[model samples]
Target: MDFSLTNEQELFQQMIRDFAENEVKPLAAEVDDLERFPIETVEKMAKIGIMGIPIPKQYGGAGGNNLMYAMAVEELSVVCATTGVIVSAHTSLCAAPILENGTEAQKQKYLPKLASGEWVGAFGLTEPNAGTDAAGQQTIAVEDGDNYIINGSKIFITNAEFAHVYVIFAMTDKSKGTRGISAFIIEKDTPGFSIGKKEKKMGIRGSATCELIFENVVIPKENLLGKLHKGFGIAMKTLDGGRIGIAAQALGIAQGAISETVKYVKERKQFGRPISGFQNTQFQLADMNTKTEASRMLVRKAANKKDKKLPYSVDAAMAKLYAAETAMEVTNKAVQLHGGYGYTREYPVERMMRDAKITEIYEGTSEVQRMVISANMLK
Candidate 1:
């Protein structure tokens, strides 16, 4: 099988890398310090077609492939994890389901706006009680003629405050358990739909995680995504793709840490010699870069499977598990190599360490990924 990127893909990567370095990188520290979303920088990303990297051109997007999208996320993540997630969530979670399952009219209505960056997108599957147990959806949707009245809350929702559109899930028939759940397309301005408490996160603070409260919110019946009572499948499938994005994000975070750590080691002296000259430091850098390379390959393998329309859930699980763990490991070492400076915000390593952590927790936890891989392997 071919493992090399096409020329077009390479160009896309280079262009995005340049943009991230020049634009998003400048704001990374400020965004984290202020805990504010960098709307201006995101607008710049959108204008450059980075926001819709994997979307087809017919839908107001750049008409890129998933692997290219992964590369783009990785490049942005190398500088700003928040920017990486913002693009990742928009493409993988929100736009993907609609593109894959929506009716022609639904696609015509939503995809262009999301792709054009006229509106950012969000997915709402997690609740206070439902995280890895996505089936335990307490949110209920009652049919009312041409409208569905939705009442539920989603916690830890990314892009909740700034998103104009959301893909949400709720129980239509509780007795049926997971099968009874259904997904919907809900607008932020819908009556009874409001933002709840904003979370102060430990990392990727600019990504905007918040509680999404829907109290008797009414939406058109036309907004029902996929088949009714079949949204549990949609939610699971959406995450299969989402995991690839998170893995790419993790891989990028690790790459960033190693690049910084290598520089620090060479310049940092111990025992009257450069730290890089020490065998111990050499081995540490070797391990960090080796793990990062492995993570990149896994992420790309998953992306390739996805792009080829092959079964990719298992590949995605493996990629996310390995890459996220690698991110945590590599970033931890980066801080250690930086010594006292790593412990303080004066260095990027400290911030990167914090950012590296969430990759393991969100999307699917490392434990959840193992379960997915094991289940698939057993099957």
Candidate 2:
């Protein structure tokens, strides 16, 4: 099987990499330092069609595939993980699901705005009590005349205040457990729907993360995303794709850390010589590069499988698990290589290290990934 990227894919990768270095990198440090959302940078990404890489052109997207989307996320992440995740959550978690499951009318109404980046999108799944236990949903949506009254809240929502559209899940029939769940499309202006204060996070601080509060929020029955009681399956499927995006983010963080470390080692002098001249540094760099390369292959393999419309749940799980760990490990070594400087905000590696951590924790933890892999294997 050919592992080479097509010419178009290669060009897209280069284009995004250049954009990250020229535009996104300039504000990354400030964004992290001030915990500011880089709205301008996001606007730039949108202008370049980065917002909807995988959505169809007829729907106002670039008509790219999953591989291109993964590549775009990776390149952006190398400079700023916050930027990477914003696009990832928008594309993989929100737009893709609607494109796949929304009724024709829903698609016609939402996809154009989402694809054009006129409407930033977010997913609302994790709640105060329902994080990894997605089936343990407490949010309730009661069917009213021609509308559903939603009353519950979600915690740890990304793009909370910034998103224009949200894919929300709630319990339509508590008696059915996971089968009772359902999905809906809620606009930001919907009455009684509000965003909570932003959370002070350890990393990726530039991305807005907050809580979503719904109190007697009302929406038309037509807002139902898919068949009632099948939202669990839709969420699981969406997360399978989301894991691939996170795996790409992890791969980018690792690669970025390595890149920073390589430049520093060649210039940093110790004991009358450059650190790159030392056998220890050389070995460490070798190990870091090897592991990062492996992560890239795994991430791309998952993307390729998804592009082929093949079963990629296990592949995505493996990619996210290994790549997330590698990002953390490589960033740790990158800090050590930088010595005292790495510990401070003086270098981007420290922030990269901080950003790498969430990848392992979110979008299904490493433990969750193992469960997915093992369950499929044993079955």
Predicted candidate 1 versus true structure: per-residue lDDT over 163-264, tens digit per residue: 999999999999999999999998879999999999999999999999999999999999999999999999999999999999999999999889888888
Cα RMSD for candidates in order? 0.8, 0.7
Against the hidden reference, what TM-scores do the models get? 0.99, 0.99
- Give the poorly placed runs of model 1, Cα more than 4 Å off: none
Q: Model 2, residue 81: what's the lDDT?
A: 95
Tens-place lDDT per residue, model 2, 1-379, is: 9989989989999899999999999999999999898889878888989998999999999999999998888988998999999999999989999999999999999998998888999999998889889999999999999999999999888788799999999999999999999999999999999998789999999889999999999999999999999999999999999999999999999999999999999999999999999999999999999999999999999999999999999999999999999999999999999999999999999999999999999889999999999999899
Candidate 2: regions farther than 4 A off: none
Q: List the residue pairs that clash in candidate 1.
A: none
